[model samples]
Target: MSTPMWKRVIARILEALLAIVFLAPLVWVIICSFSPQAGSAQSDGWGINNYLTLFNYQAGLPTYLFNSIVVSLIAVVFSVVVCTLAGYSFSRFEYPGRNLGFMVTLSILMVPYASLLIPMMVWFKDIGLNDTLLGVGLVITLFQLPMSTFIMRNAFNAVPKDMEEAAMVDGCNSFQALVKILMPVVKPSMVTVGLLAFLEAWNNFMIPLYLSSSAKSTLPLAMVNMRQQTMGVIDYGATEAGVVILLIPCAILFLVLQKYYVKGFMAGAVKG
Candidate 1:
């Protein structure tokens, strides 16, 4: 069932073209970020000045970047732990309404975040969680849970039941078996869930904007602030530089976790 040589060549050609098509804009952006203007490599003797200007601007980026990292980490950790545990339960334990429960878990994705914003805002405000990174992180964790849980459940379900039985036969408790035996088998799903959760939390603007005030913000909110401040002035060069800075972490994380990310998603899909 191998492909014909001609088809293989066509696929290689298409892949090369598609790669260029997708990467060209990113390359252009990177080039522009280093340049004071388009089609120039900061010819006016530029070198990371644009980057410095962005971070050093009034109400500078350090605090906001800290906020983003803190929130994203908290959210990612909580989301991954809760969802993975939930997924294990869903995949391994059968009980009444299990199917219905799984559907309900996934139903959140259909519920628009905007629709919940007002209610969530009011609730958080009343609970004294508003205008805080903790609140934002918790809200992010809530949104991330459904898909994370689904991915994890599928990952666990895909693992052979005999493995768990074998581990138990070796006198290991359920928890020990899960941790020592099953976890390694599903490590890819865990990485995928963590990466997705982190990216979502890091890139989120609306949640932070709504839940946080002027005194506090995440990177995404700070980016918006930068846009507004630079709007009339319109310094595309600095803005693009800031964007490149912002993109670095995401790109790095994806590159590191890509192999696992694909495997995790595919494992879930195959199981489903």
Candidate 2:
């Protein structure tokens, strides 16, 4: 049965309220970014110039931004590839220890990442992976894998086996069927997984903080630098601008992929 009219009205009102509650902080940061002297009594420093000033230091934002971009993009590619393969195996193949392997992978999510920091640092150093972007990206990909695999497995399970069989009848092998036929069917889930992987890698601070050296710091580290520019004083204006810059890519990605994200991904996830 349909929801009652009064309940529907109340739900819509609550939804609108929740949207405002979430947007409030972002709106404040945007406003404060343009503020000339944020956290000051004068309030005289409010304008669009903070954005322009972000790239004023050539070595600062640009280099860090490049590091972040490279790390995130690499992590996305690796995560999506591994997750797709793992998910396909879980969905299509029956093997001994399969369920146990999937369960072990999922168990990674149960442990606190913070708790693993010390061990991760020691392990990376021992393996000569410390102070490298590749190491950072690799660790990020591992962190994202369990969720990505879960999503992809559900997506693949939701797909009809008949389609792959039909493609095989057309002389396509399993890999070809996956690449040419089945992949299109699950592209939405792929986008969701890639977007999530990118966002997580992009926003990751502690990983980079522990693993990175001074020469190869990421954008989030740059934001931290902005926060503590001087010993006693912080530049709130630049920091807010950094926050905006950091947030823009995530917002734009969701806006662009919102259709696939909201529709296909969830429906597939709802399947076994």
Candidate 3:
């Protein structure tokens, strides 16, 4: 280990190269998003005209952004709450058909997501959820459940049984112990699950496509609609602007919670 100076240097160089490779496209998109292009609403040399165009399209940027945020937040809240309880149940309680139930839940992952949308669309319509933001969010939450449940289950399992026993010995009830003790211990996994759910719902195109109308479209659907010109030509500039808008929240969220996300996976891997 003391004689690895050259190896470290090589590793650093390789890391730099890989970073460039990954970041190059993002940088290019950001630059191109500002560059002047034909059919841009603003004829100024270089500015935010592309963004302006996107902002003014269809229901407008604010509406689409609001829809996306609403859907993503709905998915996050539902996934975290349901998965937390489920994970706790699976880890702490012994029940009939527990393993079989878990397996059945995970088996949903094997089905193609798109294939179920049409059938679910009909169900959603009958239930008064079709063409609604809540409907799309629920769909995203359903798809996210399996993996989120797995993560939370492993996180709960990785905790010590003695912790729960200690809490009970101190007179805390099961719910109180879970809320006051075990939940805090597994916060990273919760954050990871929430973040994953947010990203999935934020960028989902197909769910909204099948279950929603134009008024309920999220950012992804808006972006696709923005791409069409009067003559069927694609508006690349406006499209890139949409990419920048979409990338910002995801990038910031990931950067802020990256440590927790990695720790969450590590916690699950350590014991499971």
Report lDDT per candidate: 0.84, 0.84, 0.92
Ten-residue region with minimum lDDT total, candidate 1: 37-46
Clashing pairs in 2: 35-45, 35-46, 36-45, 36-46, 37-45
Kindly list the per-residue Cα lDDT of model 1 for residues 27-142, writing each as its tens digit: 88788777665422244665766667678766787887888899999998998889888998899988999889989989999999878987999999899999988999999999
Comparison by TM-score, 1 against 2, better one? 1
TM-score of 3: 0.97
Off by over 4 Å in 2: 1-8, 38-43, 48-58
> Global CA lDDT of candidate 3, please?
0.92
If scored against the real structure, what TM-score would every candidate get?
0.91, 0.90, 0.97
Clashing residue pair totals per candidate (backbone < 3 A): 0, 5, 0
Error of 2 at 231 (Å): 4.0
| Per-residue lDDT of model 2, residues 194-254, tens digit only | 9989999999998898888867889888677656554656777777788999999999999
Better by lDDT, candidate 3 or 1 = 3
